[model samples]
Structure formats: structure tokens, C-alpha cells
Target: MSSCHKCWHCITKRTRKDATRIVDVKQTKELSSPGAVEVDSPIGLLASTTAAFLGRARRGPLNTPVFIENFSEFRDHFGGCWSGSMLADAVQQFFSHGGTNLYVVRIANNARGARIDLPGPNGPLVLEAAEPSSTEHVRAAVDYDGIEDEKGQYFNLTLQRLAPDSSIVLDQEIYRRLSCQSDNVLFVGSELARSQLAHVCNTVPAHRPDSTGAGYINQTEMGTDGSALSDYDLIGSPELGTGMFSLNKIEEFDLLYIAPSMTSCVPGPAAVLAAEIYCRRRGTMLILDPPETWMSTSDALEGFEEAGYAHPDVLSYFPRAMSSHSATREESIAIGGAIAGLLCKLDRQSGPWEDLDQQGFELSHDLLPALDIPASEAHRLVKGGLNVIVGQRPGHAMVCGSVTLAHGSQSGDQFTSLTTRRLCLSIKNAVDSVTRRTVFKLNTAAVKEHIVADVRKYMDELVNAGALKNDRFSVDCDTNQGEKRINCTRDITISLTFDPACSDETIKLNICQAKSDSEVASQYA
Candidate 1:
């Protein structure tokens, strides 16, 4: 009996040690290569260059996504990242609320702008703004006395983007000892290419412009902000990669926000649908601002019907949050940016699992819900899949509901839960990361078994961590016996199922009272 007890003890200890080793190995693998669960995604913003005025710099590739760090970068490339531009304002809101990463896509129409002249031995050299902005003003000076090389081809050049008064230099660049000759050491092309203010044009000048130190050279033509961006502008060309499609250049993003711009046009129905499709394809969520026309709940409902949006991947805030414009005291600005910022904050702190409603999130500026929605209207709005911003004061502002613009099944209460949808996305993304590794391998049972094992491992971890209800997930990768094998389609089909972790938003309390002792005695008798 003593020997048997000792043997049992040793076996139990060995099992425990083996379990710990397995757990340690799993954790180390997860840390070394962070799967979708560990990596936080960035948000993508597609708007007009007017939203990000980069002084004299021409806008980025018409449809390319430009990664920006903060308001300074937005201002450096687009102009003022905020101010009156709705897109800029939304970006500010996103950051204030707690978003860390931002990718900006600056769109323009008919890219044209001003040109400045410089003196060159070959002819007249022309300099143009790197980006198009009506507010941009460039002034250059030739330092005839500052020629560094004995070649006499080297001279100093200074450029500036000046204020309206021409006194304050908004931005400036200086190139010393540059030569017009292509063979020269500091060729003009290479030197001026580094200039953020302007670039040397390819055309050779017939004659050099005046080198007067008293006044600076000015631009010949001003740029236009162009007409309001159409759906095509927001949808962008997949081939050219301009507009929202530019986000494809990146591997993944957390959110897609398309706010109005100085152009005054919000995304139309077509643009909204395109954004939904793109978000769905990329595993990102869309944060849509309300149309200016949605002044009332009825208006919003009517518009929602017209748009016919029913995807679970899109969320729209209503009536547009309003705040005092930073530039102008009396004018009220849109609150879309503030809401985006708050959502980012929520995502960072809690991993997008909590409902953004009733958490007491506040907007940066003195922003409030645009309309005073009555109880009935607010209910109607939420039922129709529009999230509402509600609060009496600025700091008190709070998002009232967790909902999306999706209708029918997507509009169902279970599917309407943003937390549930976000969890679903996280699971899908994580599963994708694991299964993608199995691609291009032999289509044998061993491959399928390994795929299933990886998926089950992940799902098991989620269950242990309380992210899933139980070990009830199913992952089937059996493709060898089907038509796929016969046709050599190189197809691997994977099906997954699991119940997501959820929270109880509402609880009911039942109350009852017992009959008096005297009545109970009488009834018994």
C-alpha cells in the first residue's frame, strides 16, 4: 500500500510538470510571433488634401495611404490636421479619445498649382510646390555672394512658404553649394528633391530669373480645392490605389473613417457601400458620420432605407456631434472626430470588448449631440441601427447605444452588439493567422490534422481565458475526398464554430410578498 501511494504521487507530479511545460511553450510561441489577438490595428482615414494642408508640398500620390504620427505630421503634410476640415477634426477626435496609429489618404482633383522661377546657366530653372494648396506661397532668394565652389556653378538657394502678410515663414528650406550641371557634385535634382517646400521642375529655363535680394519670387497660378469629393473619389480606383482603396497598401487597419471635408460633401450611399465592402474584406470596422440631411430620426430612417446598408461591419453615428470651431467662436463644428477618438480609447484600454455606450466617454472640444432626441426618437434610431451621442453638457457627452447600421439579421439584438462583432473579428483574424500557415502544403490528412490542432489549441486557450463559453468549437479541414481534390483546385476549406463571450446588459429583479399568518391559518383550517 505504501509503495502504491508513492507511485501515484510521482505520476501526479509528472503530469503536473508536463502540463506546465506545455503551457510555457505555448506562451513563448505566442510572444515570439504575436498573432492577431496580440497585435492592435491602426485606423485609416481617406479625405481631401485640404484636411491636411502641407504648406507648399504637393499632395501625396493621388490615391496612396500616407502614414501619419500626430497632428504635427498631419499639419506638415496636409496643412492643419484639424481646424475647419471635417476630416482633420475627426482625426483629432480619434487621437484625443486614445487612438495611437493613423493612416491618412489625401485625395485631390485635377492636381495643379503654382510655379516659381530660378536662375540656371543652362536656361531658366522652375520650382513648384510639392503639394497643391491655395494658401501656399513660395519665395526664393539666390545668394550670388555665397557661391562655395570655384566652378562658379555652385550658389546658395533659399525657399519659404510665407504667411499672407509675407512676414511669417510658415515653412522654409535652404540648399547651399548646389550646381545646375547634371555632372556637378551637388546636382540640383538630388538637392532640391530633399526640399519639402518645393522641387526643381524637369524643364530647363531659357534664361535665369532676377536674383534681387529686396523681394522674393512668387507663384504664377494658385491651386483650387476642387469640387466636393464624389463617391468615386472616396471609393477610389483599385488599379490606381487612390482614395480609400489606398488602404490596401497596408496589411490591416482597425477602423475606416470617411468624414466630410472643406469640399462640404459627405460620403454618398455608393461611397458608404464601398467602404462597407472594403472594411468587410479587410476585417476592419467602418465608423460613418451622419449625413447633414439627417436632422431628425425620421430623416435618418428614410436615408437608411435609401442607402440600403445591411452589413454588420459598419457603425454610423447620428445627427453629427457638434462643437465650437477652434478657428471661429460662433460656428459649431461636427463631432464625428471626437467620437472616433473615444472609440480608440476604449479599444486600447479594453481590447474592443466593451460597449462604447454608458462608459462616460467625452469629446475633446465643447462638443454635444447635434439634436435633442426625445425618448421615442432615440429608441427609433437605435432600433434602426444608428448609434446616438447623447449628453446635456460637453464633458458629459456619452454614446448612448451599441449598434450598427446593418439591418435584418445584422440588426438583430445579438448581432447588433458591437462587442460581440469585435470579438468575432478578433477570432476570425486570429484563426486566419493560424490557418494561413498551412496553405501551399500537401493536401494530406497530416496537413489537415495539424491545421485542426492549431485551431483547437487557439480556441482552447480562448476558452481557458474566458473568451469563449466552452471547448465546443469545430474546425474541419477535410478536403482530400471531395471534388476539390479531383479538380486539383488547390482548395482547402475550413469551417469554424464557437459561442462568443458576452456580457449581461440588463437584469431583472423579481419581488413577492407572503400572505399574513392569520390568513394562512384560516385557509389551512
Candidate 2:
């Protein structure tokens, strides 16, 4: 980086007085986010959980995404989305493949859990489901015929909170002959607080709830599932700092994934484009799931044409993944989460530069490529800017290609390779971190010399670390000699250029026969 520093110099006036004049002194310095893999994904959580953990991410100027460091926290907060949603499955698979530092952005609209009204002397007491979901139906019954307490006004209160499907009772509580009075030996407030599925409203009845003829009182006005979500719901507003964009508040993340619900409904094109733009701005890679129409190689090409995401910041995986669920076998789910897990695995086990298409790369036990892709078909998909998995069995499911879904004239082959693109991002981030610290320093010779030295030192380390090819890289931060604006006080310019280490994706070999043994040996070698 280079900046011009202005200084005042005293000049003696010929006639009477001394005057101070300003002069521009140009200073030049040459310089370079370094960290492990961090992945972030947007998931829709049950409405009940959002209120329980509202602002749990500690919202402020930097509205950091909620950091889920372990599996238990994920299960406790985001495990069941209504009837055990797809988010639970995706999170389980992500953790199973050694993913760490996972951040989840839970999406929820205005929806409350099931509510029930109990008959009371003063008024009907209202109770709401502990977790938010329309399917969380709760029931209660009063037993006045049970053993009477000392007051003879007490009754047994039995409450049952059913699952989303109402197939099983998630929680049950029976307060034996408990008085409903606010200040009694065993008040309903203290007794009902132990229920896991529902909680009492603010108001408490003065007397015990009347018996409902020994039958359970069902909830009226069941909660609605709220509005149908769209891309806007997921992207949200930057000003409001919600949804996927909220991930920007965090310090750094390596991979970002936004998977569609298991219903096979892909996120709208606008949301996907917004996510792509965010990844580009943050120096992160996005793993995109193929459209529902991408069942075959031809379909994948057509899908790319329709979507038209000609950006190297994204990697598209094709032919949905086949994994068996407890309820079903050979279920086709979105592969974006699994791909992200693999990327994290690669970054940890092997360096990021290592090709992901090599043999021996394994997938989770339950996952497999949905389609039995032949070699020719796989090649066709790879050329069309889509990554493909070639194998069919566990520990044999190797990623056959690692290409980005980029096309058109402006895009070049250099960015088409995922490794090369990631390397370029890594270099830019490293250099920016160092140079931004020297923004307003004095433009003196000593400063310039130190800046250049610092930059060269970092670049040299990168070269030694195999991130850069050699010392052919150069850092130029001096003022432009040809420009008259070199004297401009406010102008600062920086130019950084380097050749990132690129891996060969293909090799060619030729075989020939010779008459003599020596010649044949030489040719073979």
C-alpha cells in the first residue's frame, strides 16, 4: 500500500515575513483472515424454540450468528421442526462427518404453539404449548372424584401434551388433588411448571378448575403454521440483520450452505443469488444443491441454463443423494449439507489444495449417489459446471469432480477449478488483513521501507508454505510516477499480484513399441 503524507515547510519571504508551504511526501509500503475451516448454514427451527432462545446470538452492531459448538446443543434447540423436520437430519449428517464450529440461522415467522383453555370459576385459564408448532396439541382433565384434600375443594389435574402427529404423548403431568388457588399448599402454578410440553398463562384461577366430566379438554383455535416462506424469508433484510445475511456479523467462515426442505423444493433463484453475492463479498464458498429437475446429466445441463448462475463462488452438486431414513429407505435428499461436510473434512484431513476427486474419499454410511452414473455421463456433467459423485457403496462414494457452476464469456477456466478459486480467495484475505492495518500511517521513507519489508516477509512465508509458486510474486505500493496526482494528499493506492499454486487435473500418456530391448525400455520409461 502507498499513501501521500502532507507536511508544512517554512519558507523565508524576500520582503518581510516567513511563510509555511505544504508539500506532498509519498510513502510506499508492501505487505498480507488466516484460520481453520468454519461452515454456516441457514435452518428453519420450530417456532416454539425461537422465543426460548430469542437474541441468544447476542445481537448488537455485529449480530453474530448463533454458534453451535456441539451436537447436543443442536439437538436440544433445533432438533425437531414440527414433525422432526429435515433440518434435524441435515445437522445430524453434518456432525457425523466431523464438522465443527457450525453456525445455524434459525428461520421462523409469527406462529405460536398449541393452546388450551381450562374452565375456572373467575374465567377460563389459558395455557400454551411449551414449543411453538401448530401440531403441538395439548389436553387436560380434572378429577373431582379422586381423594379429597383437607379443604375438600381440591381436585386432581391431569395434563397430556401430544407430539406433532398426536401419535405419542410427549409429556404427562398429574397433580394429585392440587388446589388451583394462587396461594395454596400445592398451587397449580408451582405444580404445572414441571410440565415440559405446556405452561400456564399469566393469570391463575382463584378456585380449582371444574371437572370436565372425566374427559380431556381439547385446545380451541389451534395455532396456524404462519405464512408460506419464500426467498425473502431466507435472505431477510440487512438492516434488520436477520436470515442468511446475518451470518456476515460473524468473524469468518469457510463454507456456507443453504439447503432446501426435504420436500424437494429448492430455494428460489433470488435467495440463491443473494447467498452467492454474500459469499463473494465474504471470501467464502457456497455449496449449491441441484434443482429438482436435475435427475439426469442432460437435465443438469438444462437446469444450469435455466438458473444461469455464472459465478465461480459456487459449487453445484448433482443427482440428489440417496440416504435411508428411519421411516423410509433410499430417500433422495439435498446433497449440499453433505458436500459441505466433505469440504470441511478435506480441509482438515488433507490440505485444501488436495483434489477432492481422488479415490478413497468416503461418505457417510447412510448416503450414496442417487443415480448409478457411468464414466461418460460423469464427464458430461463435469464439463457442464456440475460436480458429481461416481460410486455407489459406503466408503466407496468418491467425489468424481470438483468444478464450479460458472460459464459464459467473462468467466475463465482458471476459476472453474474449486481449489484454484479457493487459493486465490485465501491469498486476497491474507494480504488484506496485513495491509488494512497500515491505512493512515505517516508517508515517510522509514514507513515505506518497513511496509515493504513486512509485506515481503509475509509473501515469502506463503511461498515457502506452498501457497505461492515461487518468489516470482511482487508487491507494488509506490505512488504512480507517471501521474501528476501523485502529490494528491488523500490518494492511496495498492497493487498486489501473485500466481497461485494450481493443480493439474489431467495427464496424458503415450505407449510405443521398439525393435531393440534398450529402445523399448527407454520408450516405456
Candidate 3:
């Protein structure tokens, strides 16, 4: 009988090429059956068959149905101990080739120390474990989630989804196993997760602390020491006392009207706040709406007062109970839409100011006459018009001057054609008088009626002549004064851009308004 040697040297020697020449002799005392003697065959055949079976048996038991189909062995040329990189590469290749999951077996001599290196698709990884005593090592290694060694050291590996924080929540057992050497563990997952983790580790904190007086300290105030409010001296310095004073001022206007609907409130409040801020910064006076009138009015007022501006008195609220009854959601939406349209038109008008000079037109000379204003006053009127137009485009209309040009200059000739391109109208009621009355009292309804009639007549003519695709011009009016007094005052104003050369005579006629003494006449040839 031959004894089995588990020693690496003994096993290698037995399997070496030199061992093939060794002879095996077997003799039988008697044959149990005449046919059995022939079936047993020669000693050489028996030795060859037994050696092959032993070679396969050394790998492990074949309890599991799944088995490795293709296996290759490579000798390490470096003679150094095996590493995880080698094992990781094999695993990566196997997975890449459509192998869903797999197990690896590493065989190394005791002196060399058993270690397997695999290079995976993601990156290189290593697996280290002790040599197996029997074929059971195959099953033990496959089922083992962590290492169990005599030194009581253990390691658990797991796969999981990456968290938003870039950390993975490991199973309790695995976490316990890895807790001892957390630094050695590596996480493998999606690129997004990796990126998120990188962001968290790289984020920087804001240096300056938040201010109580204001939400945040001004960046300009931050000094080299990274502290705000650090520059002033505490001693009896006038500058120090001045720094503590409020930096804003309040201005009073004729009336303060707050829009009733939140829809109307949107840009209105923002505009008011902006106006307040501007006034505060410039020491201008502004009459603010009542706190209870709009939801955000109180906060806005408080903010202004805190910023050092004087508190304003609220005069009235808009969409008065009676007037509101006549207003519909559609009307509000239409008003909003019209406001947006006006804003767009104004934007288009003002944006081209920069390009006006390139067109051989000075804003003070050629462009002003087109709108019908004198050269000297054209710049001022254009600027005022821009401000009012921007405000009115969104229903926050204000009385504004229009651009005019010098009457006699041939320079005005170049602008006549362009000036005729707009429908010019003007209203000159006293600002204080117009704002004192109710919406119904303000003769705006009648003015709006006349404006609408003219718009419809012009649009109809344009539509008939095929100059305009649709009759879309519309108008609405609201005022703070009574009807009789409103009609008496010339406070409301409106203008439109039109094509003077359009085939529609009615539309063309409405392009320019008759000149008045107070009126800045627009010249359109």
C-alpha cells in the first residue's frame, strides 16, 4: 500500500515527469473467475488509471453540481509570493466574459504563504487565506463571507448600494469584522456615488458667520482677518457712532394703493420693495402701502424701517370692494398679460438704444425727432419714457415724459419716417389730482373706452388691408379719482408702435398725435 503525502514537495515529486519512469508490479495468487482475470488487465494500465483519479481528487469534493469548466494554471516567473492583483485580474476577466459569479482556488506551498491576487474590471483586489487540509477548502472558501484564522482575526466582505453620503451601510456582521481595520476596506459601486463622495470630502465651509442685524454680513465688510465689523475703533470716535446709525430714508407720495389679489400682488410688492430699497440707498422719499393691505406689506415695511427708512403711511387698497365686483379672473389675467406685453415692447425699444448710433442716428438728434422731441430734451424724455414704460409694461404705470426733437433741423428729417412708426398719445393731468380719487371716479373708464374704440377701428382697417393678421389691440383702465374730476384732468397717457407705411389708412392716421403747448410733439413724415 502507498501512503498519501500532503506535503507540497512530496506531491510535486510524485506528479513530476521523472516519476513516470517508475515501475509498478502487481501479482495475483489465483483468479476468482476465468473472465475476471482478463478484465483486470496489466499492472501498467492499472497504475496509470489510479494516478489520474488521485490527481483530480486532490482538488476537492464535487458535492455541488456547478463546476469550473475551463481551468488554466500559470507559473509565477518572479518567484515572489502571489498577490491580490493577479486574482483580481482573473475575476474581472471571468465576469467580463459573461460568468455571473465564480469562486477561486489557490494552491501554494506553506513556506511561500498562500495568497491570491485578482485584477477585476473595476480594479485590482487580493484574497488571502490559509492552505486547506482537505477538499472541504473549496466549499469553505465559497461560503466564507469573511476570514476566520487562528489569531482570532476576521474579515467580512459585502456588496451594497452606495449612499448619498458616499458611505455604504454594511451588514452588522460585516461591519463588525471590518471595524478593526476600516482603513483597509474599499467600496466599489457606480460613478455617481463615487462623485458624490468626492464632493462631500472636498466641500469647504463659509468663513464668515451670519449676522443678526441682517441675514448675512456684506462681503465687502469682511477684512483680512476674516471678520466683519472689525475695522471700527470702540473709543469715542464719531465714525464709530455714525456706523451704528440707520442707512435709509423714507419719502412720502400722494397715495398708497395695495393690489387685492395675490396675482396682482406678485410684481407689485417686489417693485415696491425694490423702489423702497432704491429710495433707502439714495435717501429718496416713498409712500408705502398699508401693512394689512397686502400679506407681505408688513414685512416689507418692517424691513425698510429696520434699514433706517422712515415708516410710510398706507392711504388705500386697490380693487375696492365695489370695483372688485366688476373685475374677473380673466380681466386680471388680461391685465397681467398686457403688462407683460408692454414690458416686452419696452425692452425691445430700449435695447436698440445702443445700436442707434451705429444706424447713423444720435439718440439726442436723429432718434428723438422720430419720437417727436427736441434734440436737447430727447435724451431726458427717452430715459423717463424707459422708466415709465418698464413700470407700465406690468400694470404699474407712472406718468412719464416722451422723447422730442428740434423742429427745424434737417437732422430730424432722418427720424421723421421712423417716428411715424409709432402711435403717439399723451395725457397731462396733475399727478396728485389723479391719484386722489377712486377707480370708478377716475374718468379712466371713458378714456379706456375711447382708446379701445380707436384701437379696434385701426386694427379692423389693418385686418381688412391684410397688413395685420389679427385684431389684437385691447385696453383697460383704473384710477384713484372720481369720473367727472378724472375726465377733467389729463393724467392718463398711452402710445403704440405702428407701421406708418401700412396699407391701412385708419391705422396710419392714428400713428401721430396733434402737438400741444405742454405736449412733446413726435415728428413722423
The C-alpha lDDT values of all candidates are 0.58, 0.57, 0.23
lDDT of 2 by residue, 1-525 (tens): 111112111111111111122111122322212322122121111111000011111001112245564556665444443332355555556667656556665555454656788887777767776555555567878777646466556776667765546546645655565666767766667666655456677687777677787588998758644444567877878778777756645545667776455446677899889988877766678777776656788888887887777788888877877763334434577766666666666666654555677654567767777888888988888887788876776667766677886655254666788777766555444444344334334443443465556656766776676766667766655532333332333222344566666644321111111112111110110
Q: How big is the positional error of residue 234 in model 1, measured in Å on the Cα after superposition?
A: 2.1
Superior candidate under TM-score, 2 versus 3: 2
Clashes in each model (backbone N, CA, C under 3 Å)? Answer: 21, 6, 36
lDDT of 3 by residue, 40-150 (tens): 111110010000000011221111111121223211101111221122233222222223212222211111112222222233233222212121110001112334545
Candidate numbers, best lDDT first, in rank order? 1, 2, 3
- Total clashes in model 1, counting residue pairs 3 or more apart in sequence or in different chains: 21
Clashes of 3: 36
* Candidate 2 off by > 4 Å: 1-64, 81-85, 113-228, 324-330, 440-452, 478-494, 503-525
Please say which candidate is ahead in lDDT: 2 or 3: 2
Candidate 3's TM-score: 0.15
Q: On a 0 to 1 TM-score scale, where does candidate 1 land against the true structure?
A: 0.69
Error of 1 at 480 (Å): 7.3
